[model samples]
Target: GAGVSQTPSNKVTEKGKYVELRCDPISGHTALYWYRQSLGQGPEFLIYFQGTGAADDSGLPNDRFFAVRPEGSVSTLKIQRTERGDSAVYLCASSKDPSGANVLTFGAGSRLTVL
Candidate 1:
Protein backbone atom coordinates (compact mmCIF):
# COMPACT_ATOMS: atom_id res chain seq x y z
CA GLY A 1 0.00 0.00 0.00
CA ALA A 2 1.89 2.88 -0.79
CA GLY A 3 -0.39 5.46 -2.42
CA VAL A 4 0.51 7.72 -5.31
CA SER A 5 3.20 10.30 -4.56
CA GLN A 6 4.73 13.25 -6.42
CA THR A 7 8.12 14.85 -5.97
CA PRO A 8 9.38 18.40 -5.40
CA SER A 9 5.97 19.39 -3.99
CA ASN A 10 6.77 22.71 -5.61
CA LYS A 11 8.84 23.82 -8.57
CA VAL A 12 9.76 27.29 -9.68
CA THR A 13 11.24 27.87 -13.08
CA GLU A 14 11.76 30.53 -15.70
CA LYS A 15 10.00 30.55 -19.03
CA GLY A 16 11.78 28.50 -21.69
CA LYS A 17 13.38 26.17 -19.14
CA TYR A 18 12.70 22.50 -18.82
CA VAL A 19 11.19 20.74 -15.81
CA GLU A 20 10.44 17.19 -14.83
CA LEU A 21 7.87 16.00 -12.34
CA ARG A 22 7.85 12.52 -10.94
CA CYS A 23 5.04 10.27 -9.72
CA ASP A 24 4.96 6.98 -7.88
CA PRO A 25 1.78 4.99 -8.16
CA ILE A 26 0.31 2.53 -5.73
CA SER A 27 1.51 -1.03 -5.70
CA GLY A 28 -0.39 -3.34 -8.07
CA HIS A 29 -1.97 -0.52 -10.00
CA THR A 30 -1.95 -1.10 -13.74
CA ALA A 31 -3.45 2.20 -14.78
CA LEU A 32 -1.73 5.53 -14.24
CA TYR A 33 -2.84 9.01 -15.22
CA TRP A 34 -1.54 12.55 -15.24
CA TYR A 35 -3.60 15.69 -14.93
CA ARG A 36 -3.15 19.43 -14.66
CA GLN A 37 -5.22 21.71 -12.47
CA SER A 38 -5.20 25.42 -12.79
CA LEU A 39 -6.53 27.81 -10.16
CA GLY A 40 -10.25 27.40 -9.59
CA GLN A 41 -10.54 24.68 -12.18
CA GLY A 42 -11.06 20.96 -12.05
CA PRO A 43 -8.19 18.68 -12.92
CA GLU A 44 -7.77 18.22 -16.66
CA PHE A 45 -6.60 14.91 -17.98
CA LEU A 46 -3.17 15.05 -19.56
CA ILE A 47 -2.04 11.52 -20.24
CA TYR A 48 -2.64 7.97 -19.07
CA PHE A 49 -0.72 4.75 -19.25
CA GLN A 50 -1.95 1.22 -19.05
CA GLY A 51 0.93 -1.03 -18.21
CA THR A 52 4.00 0.34 -19.97
CA GLY A 53 2.31 2.05 -22.89
CA ALA A 54 0.48 5.32 -23.01
CA ALA A 55 -3.20 4.53 -23.57
CA ASP A 56 -4.41 8.07 -23.87
CA ASP A 57 -2.41 11.20 -24.43
CA SER A 58 -4.98 13.47 -26.01
CA GLY A 59 -4.99 15.88 -23.13
CA LEU A 60 -1.38 16.83 -23.38
CA PRO A 61 -1.50 20.48 -24.41
CA ASN A 62 1.34 20.48 -26.89
CA ASP A 63 4.71 19.11 -27.86
CA ARG A 64 6.17 20.73 -24.80
CA PHE A 65 4.48 18.17 -22.55
CA PHE A 66 5.30 14.51 -22.49
CA ALA A 67 5.22 11.58 -20.06
CA VAL A 68 6.34 8.03 -19.69
CA ARG A 69 5.62 4.94 -17.58
CA PRO A 70 8.28 2.55 -18.75
CA GLU A 71 7.89 -0.11 -16.07
CA GLY A 72 4.16 0.34 -15.64
CA SER A 73 4.73 1.83 -12.24
CA VAL A 74 6.55 5.12 -11.76
CA SER A 75 5.98 7.91 -14.29
CA THR A 76 7.54 11.22 -15.11
CA LEU A 77 5.98 14.26 -16.74
CA LYS A 78 8.43 16.34 -18.63
CA ILE A 79 7.87 19.86 -19.87
CA GLN A 80 10.01 21.55 -22.43
CA ARG A 81 10.16 25.31 -22.92
CA THR A 82 8.16 26.02 -19.82
CA GLU A 83 5.90 29.00 -20.02
CA ARG A 84 3.93 31.09 -17.54
CA GLY A 85 0.77 29.45 -18.83
CA ASP A 86 2.14 26.13 -17.65
CA SER A 87 1.98 27.13 -14.01
CA ALA A 88 -0.33 24.70 -12.30
CA VAL A 89 -0.48 21.59 -10.18
CA TYR A 90 0.61 18.42 -11.95
CA LEU A 91 -1.32 15.56 -10.38
CA CYS A 92 -0.85 11.85 -10.76
CA ALA A 93 -3.44 9.17 -10.12
CA SER A 94 -3.68 5.43 -10.42
CA SER A 95 -6.33 2.73 -10.50
CA LYS A 96 -6.65 -0.97 -11.03
CA ASP A 97 -8.27 -0.66 -14.44
CA PRO A 98 -7.65 1.46 -17.51
CA SER A 99 -11.34 2.31 -17.88
CA GLY A 100 -12.13 5.97 -17.56
CA ALA A 101 -14.86 5.27 -15.05
CA ASN A 102 -12.48 3.69 -12.59
CA VAL A 103 -12.08 5.74 -9.47
CA LEU A 104 -8.52 7.05 -9.32
CA THR A 105 -6.50 7.62 -6.18
CA PHE A 106 -4.61 10.88 -6.44
CA GLY A 107 -1.38 12.38 -5.19
CA ALA A 108 -0.98 15.84 -3.65
CA GLY A 109 0.77 16.88 -6.88
CA SER A 110 3.85 18.87 -7.83
CA ARG A 111 3.01 22.52 -8.07
CA LEU A 112 4.86 24.23 -10.89
CA THR A 113 5.38 27.95 -11.19
CA VAL A 114 6.80 29.49 -14.34
CA LEU A 115 7.92 33.05 -13.95
Candidate 2:
Protein backbone atom coordinates (compact mmCIF):
# COMPACT_ATOMS: atom_id res chain seq x y z
CA GLY A 1 0.00 0.00 0.00
CA ALA A 2 0.99 3.63 -0.46
CA GLY A 3 0.17 4.41 3.14
CA VAL A 4 2.30 3.77 6.19
CA SER A 5 3.50 0.20 6.63
CA GLN A 6 4.02 -1.25 10.10
CA THR A 7 5.74 -4.55 10.62
CA PRO A 8 5.08 -7.39 13.06
CA SER A 9 1.38 -6.47 13.15
CA ASN A 10 1.22 -8.12 16.57
CA LYS A 11 3.72 -8.79 19.32
CA VAL A 12 3.68 -10.64 22.62
CA THR A 13 6.50 -10.24 25.12
CA GLU A 14 7.28 -10.92 28.75
CA LYS A 15 7.81 -8.10 31.19
CA GLY A 16 11.26 -6.49 31.08
CA LYS A 17 11.79 -7.55 27.48
CA TYR A 18 12.70 -5.11 24.75
CA VAL A 19 10.94 -4.60 21.43
CA GLU A 20 11.38 -2.74 18.20
CA LEU A 21 8.55 -1.71 15.83
CA ARG A 22 9.07 -0.52 12.29
CA CYS A 23 7.17 1.91 10.09
CA ASP A 24 7.58 2.76 6.45
CA PRO A 25 5.85 5.87 5.23
CA ILE A 26 4.53 6.65 1.84
CA SER A 27 7.06 7.91 -0.65
CA GLY A 28 7.85 11.63 -0.29
CA HIS A 29 5.97 12.02 2.97
CA THR A 30 8.27 14.10 5.13
CA ALA A 31 6.36 14.06 8.38
CA LEU A 32 6.13 10.87 10.40
CA TYR A 33 4.68 10.21 13.82
CA TRP A 34 4.34 7.41 16.34
CA TYR A 35 1.39 6.94 18.67
CA ARG A 36 0.32 4.39 21.24
CA GLN A 37 -3.30 3.48 21.86
CA SER A 38 -4.34 1.62 24.95
CA LEU A 39 -7.59 -0.25 25.32
CA GLY A 40 -10.55 2.16 25.43
CA GLN A 41 -8.28 5.20 25.25
CA GLY A 42 -7.37 7.51 22.43
CA PRO A 43 -4.08 7.29 20.69
CA GLU A 44 -1.31 9.01 22.59
CA PHE A 45 1.41 10.74 20.69
CA LEU A 46 4.79 9.13 21.07
CA ILE A 47 7.01 11.06 18.68
CA TYR A 48 7.04 13.21 15.60
CA PHE A 49 9.73 13.26 12.96
CA GLN A 50 10.27 15.74 10.20
CA GLY A 51 12.61 14.70 7.50
CA THR A 52 15.61 13.06 9.11
CA GLY A 53 15.15 14.52 12.57
CA ALA A 54 12.57 14.35 15.31
CA ALA A 55 10.71 17.64 15.49
CA ASP A 56 8.62 16.80 18.55
CA ASP A 57 9.36 13.94 20.86
CA SER A 58 7.84 15.31 24.00
CA GLY A 59 5.09 12.74 23.76
CA LEU A 60 7.51 9.94 24.46
CA PRO A 61 6.77 8.57 27.91
CA ASN A 62 10.41 8.35 28.97
CA ASP A 63 13.91 7.45 27.92
CA ARG A 64 12.80 3.84 27.62
CA PHE A 65 10.74 4.75 24.58
CA PHE A 66 12.49 6.23 21.57
CA ALA A 67 11.99 6.66 17.84
CA VAL A 68 14.13 7.51 14.85
CA ARG A 69 13.74 8.40 11.20
CA PRO A 70 17.31 8.70 10.01
CA GLU A 71 16.30 8.95 6.34
CA GLY A 72 12.94 10.74 6.62
CA SER A 73 11.13 7.76 5.26
CA VAL A 74 11.38 4.74 7.48
CA SER A 75 10.92 5.03 11.23
CA THR A 76 11.57 2.69 14.11
CA LEU A 77 10.16 2.73 17.63
CA LYS A 78 12.15 1.05 20.37
CA ILE A 79 10.94 0.14 23.81
CA GLN A 80 13.09 -1.12 26.65
CA ARG A 81 12.15 -3.03 29.81
CA THR A 82 8.61 -3.52 28.67
CA GLU A 83 5.90 -3.54 31.29
CA ARG A 84 2.34 -4.86 31.25
CA GLY A 85 1.09 -1.30 31.17
CA ASP A 86 3.05 -0.75 27.99
CA SER A 87 0.76 -3.01 26.06
CA ALA A 88 -1.04 -1.11 23.34
CA VAL A 89 -1.56 -0.70 19.64
CA TYR A 90 1.47 1.12 18.34
CA LEU A 91 0.41 3.27 15.42
CA CYS A 92 2.47 4.94 12.72
CA ALA A 93 1.38 7.90 10.65
CA SER A 94 2.69 10.20 7.95
CA SER A 95 1.65 13.42 6.33
CA LYS A 96 2.76 15.71 3.58
CA ASP A 97 2.91 18.73 5.82
CA PRO A 98 4.80 19.31 9.04
CA SER A 99 2.19 21.53 10.65
CA GLY A 100 0.29 18.32 11.54
CA ALA A 101 -3.05 19.58 10.35
CA ASN A 102 -5.14 17.01 8.48
CA VAL A 103 -4.12 14.71 5.62
CA LEU A 104 -2.48 12.23 7.92
CA THR A 105 -2.32 8.61 6.81
CA PHE A 106 -1.93 5.86 9.37
CA GLY A 107 -0.89 2.25 9.44
CA ALA A 108 -2.92 -0.67 10.78
CA GLY A 109 -0.67 -0.55 13.85
CA SER A 110 1.52 -3.00 15.71
CA ARG A 111 -0.35 -4.42 18.67
CA LEU A 112 1.98 -5.10 21.57
CA THR A 113 1.00 -7.43 24.39
CA VAL A 114 3.35 -7.31 27.34
CA LEU A 115 2.54 -10.15 29.66
Give Cα distance to truth, residue 36, candidate 2, Å: 0.6
- Stretches off by above 4 angstroms in model 2 are none
In the order shown, what is each candidate's alpha-carbon RMSD? 1.0, 1.0
Candidate 2 residue lDDT tens string, 2-104: 7789999999999999999999998988889899999999999988888999889999998999888887789999999999999999999999887777588
- In candidate 1, position 45 carries an lDDT of 93
TM-score of each: 0.96, 0.95
lDDT of 1 by residue, 1-115 (tens): 5788899899999999999999999998899999999999999999989999998999999999999988888999999999999999999999987675689999999999999
Error of 2 at 83 (Å): 0.6
Cα lDDT over the full model 1: 0.94
